[model samples]
Target: MNALAAQALISARRALHQRGELAVRVAFYAIILVIFSALWSAAAGANGGSISGYDAHSLLWYVAAAEGSVIATKPRMIESIGWDISSGAIVTEMLRPASVVGLRLAAELGEALVRLVCSLAVGGVIVWLYVGQPPSAAGIALFVPASFLAVGCNLAAQHAFAGAAFWLRDARSTWFLYQKLVFLLGGMLLPLEFLPTALADVARALPFASMAYVPARLASGHVEPWLLLVQAAWLAGLLACAGGVFWAGERRLEVVGG
Candidate 1:
């Protein structure tokens, strides 16, 4: 545990050292939010006071929450794992007195924490400019835990997918597929409430919804304890699945040369 904390701090400092890149990423976040705000405003105007359950203002906020969640965790774990496998770095990591998966997860959590702050800061500015108000304090408080759990859920899913690199020698295809699933079913571009009832129910049953939709909804003042409970369940299941994959992948690991 102590070693994991130290690794997390090291990763956080590494992210801090990449401040220039983070600044550029934050700029892109602001631009995307602005574009979404305009599109939502036009749609709301065309449809009347509100489109679905969200007014223009609340819709923008919802989107901000959703986009912020997306930006916060960029799924770099897959690429990192793939690289470690292909480059034989996993062997070196295995020698360390720590669980490789746990260490990487802690590091990713550190990176995600830093990204979440930067994204939220940029998102907060855009929300103020376009929506003119902050999310409810109570809502933000509730969202913090859910969002953290969402991060863990995301890591588990990514680790499970990335474990394929041990066999495929590359996990880019898996990552791409997962990205599309998250974009379409995780409510990155639109709230699940806006989806057809049947479609929304299907998506809700999947892990993707727990990452983006549930957290965003909670942040937008939609309190649902059942959603949080479901997210926790998903987290536990995903973690177990990840651990199983890790064990299998490690067993299959073979290095051809130094």
Candidate 2:
């Protein structure tokens, strides 16, 4: 446990050391928030009122929350797993006493914490500057846990996708497609409430929604305590699936060359 914690801290420190990368991502986060605020404002005007119960202010807050979740999520675990599997570097870790998935997840959590802070800072500032009202106290309380679970869910999902490297030479394309699905269906760019009723229901049923949509919804004052249960269930399921994939993959793993 202590070793895992140490590894997490080291990984987080390493992630924070990439200050240039963080700055660029923060800049992009601000840009996207501004652009979406403008677009949603226009859409609200055309609709003659709020769209799906979201006025311009709430909509901007929604965008900020959604974008902040994405910014906070670091999906590098997929690429790292895929590369390790392909290069046979994972074999070394497999021989260790600690579980590879556990270590990687711990590390990812550390790295994600740093990004989450940076993202929320940027998004919160923008929301404050534009909307001028703080999110509901209850909403903030609920959102923090939901957002953390969302990050964990994403990491588990990516690890599962990374396991595909055992069968496919590279899993980058799968990861890419999965990410796009999250971006679209998970309410990263647009809230699920704005979607057609059927589509929104489907999104809610899927784990992707738990990743971004649920947290954003909570932050926007949609108080649904049940959503946290849904997120927890999805996170558990994803972890089980990912664990199974890695367990099976490791048993059949082979290294051909030095």
Using all chains and alpha carbons, the TM-scores for the candidates as numbered come to 0.92, 0.93
Candidate 2, residue 191: the lDDT equals 93
- Across residues 81-124, which tens digit of lDDT does each residue of candidate 1 receive? 88787676787877788777888788887888788778887797
The digit string of per-residue lDDT tens for model 2 on 169-249 reads 586656678887888799988999878999988988888998888888888877788889999999999999888888778
Clashes of each: 0, 0
- Residue 68 in model 2: shift from native, Å? 1.3
Off by over 4 Å in 2: 75-77, 254-258
Give the Å shift of residue 166 in candidate 2.
1.3
TM-score of 1: 0.92
Model 1 per-residue lDDT at 55: 79
